[model samples]
Target chain A: MFITSAYAAADTAAKLGEEAVKKKNVFPPFDPSTFTSQLLWLAITFGIFYFLMARVVLPRIGNILEVRRDRISQDLEEAQRLKEETDASIAAYEQELAEARKNAHTIAREASETAKLAADKERQKTEAKLANTLAQAEQTVRKVKDAALAQIDTIASDTTQAIISRLIGTKVTKAELAKAISKIAK
Target chain B: MATHPDPIKQFAINKLLPLDINGVDLSFTNSSLFMVATVVLTSAYFLWSTGGRGMVPTRSQSVSEIVYEFVAGMLRDSAGSSGMKFFPFVFSLFMFILIINMFGMFPYFLTVTAHIIITIALAMAVFLTVLVVGFGRHGVGFLKLFVPSGVPMLIMPLVIAIEIISFIARPISHSVRLFANMLAGHITLKVFAGFIVSLSAMGTVGIVGSILPFAMTVGMTALEFLVAFLQAYVFTMLTCMYINDALHPGGH
Candidate 1:
């Protein structure tokens, strides 16, 4: 605003003076040097930031990072150790399990074998007992059948002799009647 | 030459807002939009990818699986088997940033990870997590992280102090590295674009500005694409490393 007003006043003054007046620009406007300033600031900013990071911050982070790395590896080693211990216990338990399984199989086999042997022995004993009872019953039935057959024969002979005596109305020889009866019966 | 007067100008989407507060004008910049885009796109992609998964992987499913396995492999490399615990966080960070950069190739969607504040915040989160987890696991022994084993008495104090400062500055450098690269690239692109306009306005004689920025733009774009990927990986990789610190304080 001041420059414009001064220039207007100068124009008026120039007409008054009638002599020519020089016009000068006290300040130059554009500076290409600002690019250089910009480059300078960029470099400085980068340098300062880099120093703070590489020299100061990065190392601290590196420390924590290193710690983190170290911690992980150590934990892994510890885990491996625990894992080994667990594996050892598992191996021992598995071995015991195997042994127990073997024992169980053996016991089961023996029990089954014993049971079969007992069954076989019982079957043989039963078979022998049945055979003995069959023999005893057969002997008793044969003796009773023989006694009844003798009684039946004796009764038939007496009836025949009595009937023959009634028909003739007289007594006959016992020996002769016996002889005749034997021949007829045959 | 056949394209617009300035392609780099196209890189920045100007959505002027009417809000101002504390003389600190806050507007939804392309960067902010891209950040939101990155998040939304990531969620959408994952959701869509795994939406219809069966025993066999479809194409999207395969892509999702590949990403999962890739991040898983990185976690295992940096954090060991137990590092599986941090799979979700590391994977999310990688995918989120990756998507942001990739999507930024579109006319819209700013590369949010390109911003210093965002990157710094991410790095700071990792730094804080490492600190908390380290101390929480090992307690005072964590301080010994700075004091190395078998250090001589004379320089121990100085070494410890330096170590502390360096530790504190990790997040700043990590974040700035990503932030500065993105910002510098964008700014340079913008400036070169200004040249293209001026040279063209100078009639047929001024067409020379086209050749240089064009070459630079292609080269920078290629480099930026790579940077986008590298930064995300770097961030996630660093995060995995930090989580590893938590898992194994002494590398057991």
Candidate 2:
């Protein structure tokens, strides 16, 4: 009964001071009787709290923070490595492209040079053959003319003999006729 | 007519479980219940918030994280990173006091910090830690904190005496500052509320008059909410400063 009805005694004990120390009030906070329990619970609660903070909760938070930081750094490093690789590959590709273009240009030039040289050689060969064939034809024409001239001389000598015989009833010399025809033909 | 309400009545403690051992009043008081409740609630919040323990934090997790960082930053700024060893003590103190202060604001709930015994116990803990760490780390050189570097030899004794007094008074002031603030703030709020009740009982004009006190009471309650956080912060900050002094004696 005395234990359950403690607050009933609190007010009077608070106002009266030391006279009511035996029937102490808890409101004053300095109540020596209640100090024991308050201090006891405070110690217990704070002890558990300290343990939780020092061991469990704080370390968890720290771990989360540290993990996040490490993950972010790793991501950044991966990104950097990827970027560098991309840049290097691009450079290599560009170099290869330039080399390929150069190679193509040189091949085209060599092909064109070869084609021009071949064309010039073919034209020269054809020109030389045509000149040789034209010279041979000219020589044949000259030979034929000479033979025709000789024949003309012979014909003249015979005509001369016949005319002479018909007009004057006298024949000319064959040698003299032949000589005149040859001079005329020349 | 009902007599004037005792503002102090709200602070009264009752024996919930009558326990005594070796003449000690170990009965479970209301104060013990709230203190236990504070512990339970704080622990539950942390455990529940971080239960998922996901990389991306939830709301309560964020809150807990922010509180941790906030205390860490305070300790780092005031006491340097070396002072981080005391992080648990300061953080627990801050959270315990903060929860108790917030709980006290609830209707019909008692503010535990309003008690000198509790505040003094906390202050003494800080004070004792400072002494132990200071002497342990700095040895006899720790006493140099009481004697400033630049003081003339003539006024050195005076200054030392004053420093010693202040040093001794650290726990007293620290404890009293919080206790008095909560005690007075709550008392003033009760007094204003009392005015409103008494005024409203006197009919129309009195009821109209009662509105002023009613409004003031609302405003004061809001202020008390702010004070609750502010006092907790101040206490934690002071603890950091004291710890800092221990770590670097005579540096200040």
Candidate 3:
């Protein structure tokens, strides 16, 4: 049964081959009859494809790419500008800080110098007042000493007169006693 | 009786809509259907992927963009920035061929590129575009492409003749390369598959032996997929180089 089926298949294959040969002696590709149809369809389809590509599709894709590139570059430029602005502000802040510190240093020095001058003037005034008080005290001491010396002279004269009278039981004359006292004092 | 599996039967064209213009048999065959499908699929993918036009591409959008950039970069490298004017044309050819070739990779799909007429038509389009652009840009000076600079005066004529012949033969080679690759790859795959079928019909031992051809068929299918992509790349790359030649006929 298998052999018979195989033989029948071979016979049918041969018949198909004969039929193909009868229809066209040439190979299907080499057959000139079908060229026109193939060419016609290729031209039509390729023409449509070219039209769609050129008119609609490619340009849109290209535009998308272009826009994306432009956006990226613009973003980069904006970032760069912001960075520069930040740097400038920081520099200005630092400079102001430095200037403020210098001003504070100058003001402190001026205040110390004024305080020192005031202190020196105050000390000199006190020293002059003290000297005046010391001179007056010395003059008063001298006057007191002179008054006591005068009193001492008077007292001595009286005492010497009294002693003479008491001892000798005689009344001595002032001139005589003075003459003796003067000689003794001398 | 099991029907005989004809490998060549896969390549046969079938009329879907019988079209006639004048005396021409321009019927909408299976080939036409595939071509239309390729166009529609390619168009839909690009349109849908790029619909959002997002600054950051979505996954589908990224795929679309990658293909766009890949072809653009290839063209820019071979043809210089000035040749970017032909970007749409080159892009269409690349995408169309690529999608159609991929379509052909299915089990029972018609390979539009497998047809000689289709490939020749594409190559001829490129050829004619080169002629037009070369002449339009350079005028008579385009003939200088045939004459190399610094050739010895004794051998100058011979060189120009050879250059002209090669130039004339460009379309033939370009078209045949794609057609033959698709045709041969598909045929090889079908033949191996046929072996498996016939072997399995034999019996228990035949089924075991069929494993070898089955593995081979799998391998061939994988290779065919690669060829589909590679041939598309090669075809477009050559297109770029040719356009470059036209744009700069001096070959500098």
What would the C-alpha RMSD of candidate 3 be, to one decimal place? 8.0
Q: Please, what are the lDDT tens digits per residue for candidate 1 over residues B1-252?
A: 544454333333333443344644345544445555555555556556655543445787567666767887899998998777656556666776677667755443455555445666667767887888789878987776677767799999998899789778888877787666665665565566666766677777678757776677677777777877887788788788778866675552
lDDT: the better of candidates 1 and 2: 2
Q: Tell me how each candidate scores on DockQ against the true complex.
A: 0.01, 0.46, 0.56
Docking class of 3: medium
Off by over 4 Å in 2: A1-33, A120-186, B20-23, B146-163
Q: Residues A1-186, candidate 1, lDDT per residue (tens digit)?
A: 999999999998887565222111111111121223223322343334334333433343334445656878999999999999999999999999999999999999999999999999999999899989988888888888888887765666677778878997766566766777778889
lDDT of 2 at B250: 83
The fraction of reference interface contacts (C-alpha pairs within 8 A across chains A and B) present in each candidate is: 0.00, 0.65, 0.77
lDDT of 2 by residue, A1-186 (tens): 786568657855676675465443445655566778888888888888889878888888888878878989999999999999999999999999999999999999999999999999999999999999999999998899889876876777888889889999887798877777678868
**Residue-level lDDT tens digits of model 3 in A34-125:** 88998888889999999999988899888888898999999999999999999999999999999999999999999999999999999899
Q: Write the per-residue lDDT of candidate 3 for residues B50-78, one digit (tens) a residue.
A: 99999999999889888889999999999
TM-scores for every candidate against the unseen true structure: 0.51, 0.77, 0.78
Is candidate 2 or 3 superior in lDDT? 3
What's the number of clashes in each of the models?
A: 23, 0, 0
Model 1's DockQ?
0.01
